[model samples]
Target chain A: MTQSLPSASGTPNPCIELSNVSKSYGLVPALSNLSFAIPEGGRYALLGPNGAGKSTTLKLLIGSLRPDSGRVSILGSPPDSRAAKAEVGYLPEDALPYRMLSVRENLEYIGSLRAVGDLKNRVDYLLDALDLREYERSNVGRLSRGNTQKLAIALAIVHSPKVLLLDEPLNYLDIPTQEKVIAMLESLQGTHLVSTHIMSIAGRLTDSVVMISKGTILWKGAIDELKRMGSPDEPIEKIVARMMTGAI
Target chain B: MLFRVLKFVLRTRFSRPFLGFILLMIFYSIVISRAIPPTGISVIISYYIVGIVAFFLAMSLATGGVMVMKSDRDFLFTLPLSSRDLSIAIFFSQFIAYGVTVLLLFAYLSQAFSSALLLVDLVALALTLTSLGTIAPSMTTKGRVSASVLLALWTSSALLKFPFTPGSAFSGSVVYGTATLVVLAAATVTIAFRNLPHVELDMVKSMVRSSSSEIKAPNSYVGKSPVSAIYFMNLSNMSLAGRFNMAGTARYVSKRVKSTWVAAIASAGAAAYVAFILIAYGAVHFSAAPLPAQIIANVILGFLAFAFSQSAITYERIWLSLTSLPPATYFRNLIAAKVLSLMLILAPFAVADAALAYLGYAGALASMVVVAVVIPGFFVLEVCWAAFTAPIQVKGDDMLMPAQFNLRQMAAAVPLVAVMGIAASASGVLDIALIGGLAIWVVSASLAVSGGFWNSVVSRLTESGFV
Candidate 1:
C-alpha cells in the first residue's frame, strides 16, 4: 500500500535516505559517500555491476551493515532503531532459510516471529503464489536450490514489509516465475530499493534508476532519463555498460 | 604435470605439519616399545592382532577421508584430464596423506619386532588397508552416510578385538595373509575406476546455481512484526540471540526437545558405564574407602558438566538466523530455553540420586546436587560466555576468530568455574549456590547488555565486511 503523504515541507521527506554514506573494508572502499533517497511509495532501482555497493547499500538500509561515515535513515528513524526495522522488510543477498526446517515450518516460524496478521493465510498465499505448495512439507535442505530460494523469497515478503530492500530478488527463478514475481512486485506500493546488475530487472521492478560505480553514485534519475542518455537505436544494456566503465 | 600436482599437495600447510607430527610420534612410540622386554609368543600374538586392528582403523579413516575428497571431486575432475589419470592422481594424492600416517605406524612396529619379515608384513598390510579405504567413497554418492558407516564398522571392530584374534597363532605364521591383501588392492582399484567415469563436473556449477537463486524483491514487507523492528535494530551487530524471529524461536524450542532427549539418553548410557567401572573397581579392591569413590564420581561429573557446557553454545551454530533479532531478547530466550532443556536432561538422574540418598547410599545426595545444580550452572555460564563473547555474524558461516582473547571472557569463565567448583565441593547445599549464582549472573549480565556494546560489535562486523 502507498504511504500517506508527509507534512508540507516541499522537501518531500523520503522514507529511506542515505546522505554521503561511505563504507570501506580494509584498503578497499565498498561504498563511497553515496547519497540517494526513496520517497514514501517511490520504487527505485540501485543499479550497478558486481561489487558496485548494491548489496552493501541494501545492507546499510536494512541495518545489516552500518555506513563507515554519514547518515542512513529508514522512515526518518535510525537504521538500527526498532521503529525503523518494524517498517522495513529486507531480503538479503542469497537469502538462506533455516535448512533443517520444512518449507511450511519455515514460513510459519518466520511468519509468527514477524507477528504477521493472519499468518497461516499469508503463508498459504505465498506458497500458492510461489508454486511451493508441493514442497511445503519438505525440509529446505532436501529441496532443490530453486525451491529453497523460493522459500527464502516467501519468508521475506510474508509480512508485507513497508520499506523493502531487495538485492537481486530474481536470481534463480525460471522465466515464467520471473514474470510472476515481477508482476507481484509491480503490484506492491511502498518506498523500495532494488539492487541488481540486470537492466531488464531494473526496468521491470523500478521506475527511477540510481547508477553507482566503484562505490560512488555516477547518476540518479528516471528510467526514461537513463534511456535518453543512450542513442535512440542503442540498447539500454550498452548504455549502462558505458556508464559503469566510465566510457560515457 | 604429475610432479606439479604432487608438489602442491605436499606443500600445503596441513600436509607438511601432519607428516612431521606423525613421524615424531612414531619415533617416540618406537623408542618406548623397545625399552620394554617382550614376553615371547603372547607378545608377538598381541602385536600381530594390534597391527591388524590398527590397519583396519586406518582403512576406515581413509574411507571417510575419501568421502571428504569426493565432496570436492568435481573441482579436480574439471582440469581437462582423463578418468584414469584422475583416478591415478587421486590414488597418489591420498597415498601421500594416509600413506604418511600408515608409514609412521609401520616404522614404530618395525622398532619393536626388529625383523625384516615383520617389517615387510606391516608395510604390505598398511598398503592393502589404504587401498581398501578408497572403496567406500568410490561406491557411494552420499559422503556422510558412507563415512558414518565406515566409522561405525571401525569402532565395532576395535571394540570386539578379543573375539577376533586366533589365541594360539604366532605372529610369523600366515593364516589368511597374501590372499586378503590381493583382494583388498584389487577392490580399491576396481571401485576407483568404476566411479571415476561417473564423476560429473556439473556438480560444482549446479551447487553454485542453487545457492544464488533467492534475490529479495523491493518493497515486499512494509508493515509486519514488532520483532522485525528488533531484528532491524541489531541487524549490523547480529547477535546469536537476536536472530530469533517467530520461526527461529519455534525451532529454538524444538531444538531444546531434541537436544535434551539426546542428552538424557547419553547421560543414562554414561551412568550405566560409570556404574560398571565402579563395580569392577570395587570387585578388585574390597577395602577401598567410600570417600575416594565419591571423589572419583565428583571429578567425572565435573568433567561431564564442563564438556557439556562448552559445546552448548557451539551447538546453536546451526540456528544462526536467530542473530537477526536483538541480542538482549535473543539471549534471554536462548538462556531460558537452554535452562529448561538442561533441567529436562538432568531430571531423571536427579531423581535416581535422590532415591539413592533416601536409601542412605554413599554420597548419593552429593552426586544428585552435582548433577542437578553444578551442571545447570555450567550450562548457564556457557550460554552467557557464548552470548557475550561469540556474537553471531549475519552471514552465519563467518569463521569466528577466537573473540580477541579479552579479559572479559576470561573473567566470565573464572566465576563460572569457581561456582561449579564450589558447588561440587559443597555437595548437598549445591542447590543454594546454583540459585544464588544464577541470580548474580543474571544481574551481572544485565549490566553488560547495553546498546553501545552491540553497536560497537556491529560496527566492527561492518568494518570487517562480514554483514
Candidate 2:
C-alpha cells in the first residue's frame, strides 16, 4: 500500500514522489511498499539507520534505479524523463566525480551539459562559493575527501535544480564546510531531501523527517512534532532510535 | 609456523580455476616437448622467446609487482608472526605467481637441451623473471620505464648474438647463457627479498606521487555545447591501456594522456610502418602484397580500438551525465567522440594503405578500406555490444587491489577476435573485404546515431548495476 505524508506547506503537487515503490537486490528487498512525497519547496530528511533503504530510496527518486513494483516521479513526470531529469540534481553517497578531470572541468562540464546559462560564470560562482577556487585546477583524484564532497555538492546544484537529492551529503566534510553547506542548502529555494543517518545533519538541513526502517516508512511529520515526542533533555536521536527499533 | 603460514597463503590465494589452468598448461608443455624432435625447433624461435620475455618483464614493471590482497593488510599482517617468516611466504607466493610464465615459455626447449644442466638453467631463468616482477612495485615510474628499456636493449642484443644473453642458450650458447642466468638470478633475488616486506608502502607512495605531479589543465567549455563538451572531454583525457580483473576488484592502468597525443603517437608510428613497407618491397614494383604485415597492423589497430572502447565510459558518472542530458543524446555523443578520436589514428594508416594501393600493391586497397572504414565501425559495434555482454562497474580509483580473473572477461574479447579473423581473411582478398567493410560501416553508423539504440543500451547499463 502507498503511504503519502501530509504536505508540510499544503502545496497540492510534490516536487518528488514515490508511491508503493518496492525494490529488491536479487532476493533481498531494499525497499518494501515504500511511499513518500515532498511538496514544492518542502525540505525533509529521509532518515534511517544503516541498510534501512535510505540510499535505495534516493536512487529511485533520481531514476538511476527502477522500482520493482510502484511509481516514482519528479514533478509529476517520470524520473527519467527529460523534464524531470532537468529539474533534479543528485549527489550520491561517497560521490566520486571524474578522477582524471580537474575541479573546474567537472563543474564546467556538468554545467555545460545541464545547459546552464553562461556556464563559465556559473562554474566560477560554484568554485568561489564552495571554497573550491584554490583547487579548481587540481585533479579530483588528488583532492582531499572533504574537497571532493564540496565539488560534488557544487555539481548537484550547478544548474540550480528545482529538486535536489543528496545521500550522505556531509559524509566527508569538515565542520566549517559542513556549516557552509548547510547554510547554502538552506538558502536555496527548492525541494530538498537529504538522506543521512546522522540526526544532527537532518535537524540542521531540513524542516521535517521521514523515518524509515526495514524498507518501510516508520514515521513522518514536522521536526517540531518529532521534538515534542521526546521529554525534556531527550536527544532527538534517542526518540528516532526508539521509533526505528519499535521501542516507542 | 613458517610451513603452516606458507600452506595457508597458498591455499587461500589461488582459486581452483587458476590452479587448474596452470596444471593444464604444464601438461600441454610436456606433451609438446615429447613430440618435438631435438633439432626440429627453429633458431627463429629463439627471437620470439626473447621478445616474449622482454614483453613480460616490461608489463610486470608497468602494472604488476607483488600483490597483497586487502585481506592481508586487514587481517594477516595483524598476526604476531615473524616478519621474516611472513616475507618468505610472500616471496614464495610472488615466485609462483610470476615464474610460471617463464617456466612454460621455455618448457618446449627441454628436449633440445637434454643435459642435467638444463634443469639448473630453467630454475635460474624462472627466478630471474620472478625477481624482476617482485622488485617493480618499489620503483618509481621513471625507474620502471628505464629498467624496461634496458631489458629491451639486452634482449635485442641477444638477436645480435650477445653470448651471455638469456636467449643465448636457445641460440646454442648454452654454457654462457646458463652462467648469465645463475648470476643474474642471485643478484635480483637479493634485491627482491630486501624489497618484499615494504610492498604496501611503496604502492601507496607511488600512487600518491603519480596523482599529484601529473595534473593537466582543465579543458575549457566556454563556447562548446553540451554534447561537444563531452566529446572534447573524452577526446582530450582518456586512458588507452588498463588492467581489468573480475570479482569487482579495482583496476590499475597506465596514466591518462590527452587522446590527441595517443592518436598523434599512433599516426607517427603508422608513418614509420609505411616507410618500412615501401623500403621492404620496392615502391615501384610491388608483387604479391605483404599479407602478414597488413594483418599484423590491422590486429594492432583493432587492439587500440578495443582498449579505447573499454576505458571510454570508465570515467563516466552516469548519475551526473545522464541527468544532464537524455541517455540517447549523451551516449550518441560519447560514442561519436571516441570514434572520432580513433579516426585520428586510423586516418594516417588508411592514407598509407592508399599510397601502397596506388602503387599497385596487391590487397592494399582492401586493407586501406578496412582501416579507413571497417575499424571505426567495429569500435562502435564493440562499445554497444560490451554494454550488454560484459558490463562491469569500473573500479573508482587506482588505490585498490588488482583485478581478479573471471570467465565473463573472455566474452568481452569475442568482437575483437571476430574482427581479427575478418582482417586475416581480408588480407588475401579485396572484393569480399571491401563489401564486408562497407556493410559494417553502414550498420554501425546507423546504430551509433540511432536514439532507440542508445535507449536500449542505457536500459541494459542501468539494469547491470552500472549506475
Candidate 3:
C-alpha cells in the first residue's frame, strides 16, 4: 500500500517535489538548480549550515516565494494552490503569534479558519496539552518568549494539516516544554519536513536526511545512511560539519 | 562631580547642538529686540515659555528619554559615581540644557535677561521639563506616533491656552503656576532618582492581531453568494456590515482603532467638527460657515482616514498568517473594510453637516452618494499603493524604512482631483452623482485588476525579509 514517489528511491509520486527549481534575491542566489522530493508521509530533515538557503527552500515549499525557474509542487498541485495551502502546516523559525490576541483567542481564530471539526474540543485539548491555560486570557504580547513559542506551535497545528514544514520548531522553549512539543509533534500524522542545524532535533524528529549546502542538495538518505558515510569511529556531527564545509 | 558631569555631557555631544541652537536664537533675538514693541512682550514671553516646554516635551516623548539615562546609568554606575552624582548629573544636564533654551526664548521678549526672579522661574520651568521628560518613559505608556507631521501638530497645539505670562509676573496666578511646576518637578525628580535602577521599555505592540480570520471574504465572483454567520463571528470588534459582509474587516480595524486611542481622539475631533458646523450654520448669524472651519474639519477626517487605514498597508507580520486565506478575497475585503470604517466614521458627520447647514437633505444625499463613489474608490488604490510602500517593522533590531515615494498614491490622486473638478463645474447634485458613478466603474475595475499587482508586491516584500 506504499505510495510511489519521484525521489532517489523512486517511490510513488511525491507529496512534495521541486524539479530543477532555483530562486534568488537580487544578485544573491538562494537556491540554484535545486531538485528534491518526498513521498507521501515521508519524515525528512532539511539540514544545512547558516546561509545554506535552508530558510529560502522552506519558504519556497510553503509558496511564500516563487522559484525563479523550474517547478515546485506540493501534493501534486502548485505550492500556492488552495489544495496545498489547506494541507500544509508551517512553523517558521522564531514564529510570532499575534501580540494583541489572547492565547485562547489566537488558537480559536486560527482553529476556526482551519475549520477543524469540533474546533472547541480541539482547541481546548491543545490549550491543556501546551500548559497554556494559566495565561489563556492574557494577550500574547504579555507572554514570555517560551509561552509565545508554545502559542505559535498551537497555531501551526490548529488545522491538523497533512504536511508539516517546521523551521526550528523547538526554538525558545524550555527543556520540559521541548520534550512535550517533541511528543506532541510525534503524535501528528503527516509528511514532516523539519529544517534545523541542530543534529539532535533532526535525529529525533526525522529518519531521513536531505543535507544541503550552498543551496543545493549535497547528500540525502536515511539518517543511518548519513552516519555510515563518515569514518568508522567518527561522530555524526563531525561528518555533517565536514559535508557542509565540503571537507567530505 | 560637577566638572566630571559637565565633561561627560560635553563628550557625548548631545547638548552641543541644543546649546548652539539656543545661542543662535539668542543672537537673533538680541539683534531684533531694538525694533520690537514692548507691548507684545506679554504675548511673546507667553508663547516663548510654552513653545520651549512643548518642543522638549514632544522630543522627550518621541525618544522615550531613555537613551541618556540608560547610557549614563550603565556607564557611570560601574565607575565610582554615587547616586547623588548620578541624579545631579542627570538633573543638571537636563536643567542647563533646558534653562539655556528658555533664557534665550525670554531674550526674544526683552533686550536683556529681564530680572533675577525671571531667571529663577526659568530655572524652575526647565527643571520641571527635565523631570517630566525623565518620568515619561517610566510610565511605559503606549502612543504609536510614527508620523512626523502629526507630532509637529500636537506639539504646536500646546499654545492653545496659557494661564500665566510675563504680563502677569506679579499676579497670584503666576506665583501659583510657578509653585505648582516647582512642586511637580521636585516630586518627579525624587521618584525618578529612587527608581533609577529600574526603567520600563516602551514595547506597546498592535492590539489588533488581524483584520479578519475569515476563510473567505466576499468578492465580485464568489462574494455574489450569501455570507455565513461564522463570517460575522470572526470579526474582532465591529458589528456586521449588512448584506456586503464587510464586518470582519471593519470589526478587526475598529477594535484595533479602539486599542490605539489616538484614533478615538481623531474620531471625537471629527464629531466635534460636525457639531461646530451644525451650530454655526443652524444656530448662528452666519449664512454659510467659514471656509477655514470646513477645511479644518476635512483635514481632521483625512487624518483619521489615513490613521485608520494604516493597518491595511503596514501588515508585515500579519501578512504571514494572512497568506493562509485567499489573497484576493482578504485584500479586497481589507480595502473595502478600511474605506468602510473611514466612511462610517466620517460620512454621517458630513451628511449631517450638509443637511443641517444651508445645503439641506438633497445636498446631504448628494454628498453621501458622491462620497460612496469617491472614498472607497480612492482608498482601494491608496491602500494598494501604501501596502507596497510601507513595511511594518517587527520589533527589535530592524529599523523601519522611511516612507517611500508613493507613485500609486500620486496616480490615485489624479482621479480624485478629477472628481472634485467635476463637482466644482457641475450645476447640481444630480450632475455630481452622474460623474461620481462613472468614476466608481473605473475604480472598481482597478481593484479587480489589482489582485495580481498586490500579489507581486507582497511576494517582493516577503523576499525582502520585511516580516
Best by TM-score: 2
Off by over 4 Å in 3: A1-10, B1-134, B140-235, B238-271, B280-286, B313-320, B357-379, B395-449
Q: Which ten contiguous residues of candidate 1 chain B have the minimum total lDDT?
A: B245-254
Pairs with steric clashes in candidate 3: A4-A11, A4-A12, A4-A13, A5-A11, A5-A12, B238-B251
* lDDT minimum window of 10 residues, candidate 3 chain B: B242-251
Candidate 2 has which clashing residue pairs, if any? B246-B404
lDDT of 3 by residue, A131-210 (tens): 98887777565678899889888888887888899999888999999999999999888899999988989998989999
lDDT of 1 by residue, B370-406 (tens): 6666666666665555444643332322222121223
For every candidate, how close is chain A to the native chain A in TM-score? 0.94, 0.94, 0.94
- Model 1 regions lying over 4 Å from their true place: A1-8, B8-75, B82-85, B88-133, B138-264, B267-271, B274-324, B335-467
| Model 2 CA deviation exceeding 4 Å by range | A1-11, B1-39, B69-71, B106-123, B201-216, B244-251, B283-285, B393-403, B435-467
lDDT of 2 by residue, A168-240 (tens): 8998888998999999999998889988888888889998999988899999899889989999789999999
Steric clashes per prediction: 20, 1, 6
Ranking by lDDT: 2, 3, 1
The model with the greater TM-score, 2 or 3, is: 2
- C-alpha RMSD for every candidate: 9.2, 4.1, 9.5
DockQ scores of the candidates: 0.18, 0.56, 0.21
lDDT of 3: 0.58
Worst 10 residues of 3 chain A by lDDT: A1-10
- Tell me what TM-score chain B of candidate 1 gets against the true chain B: 0.49
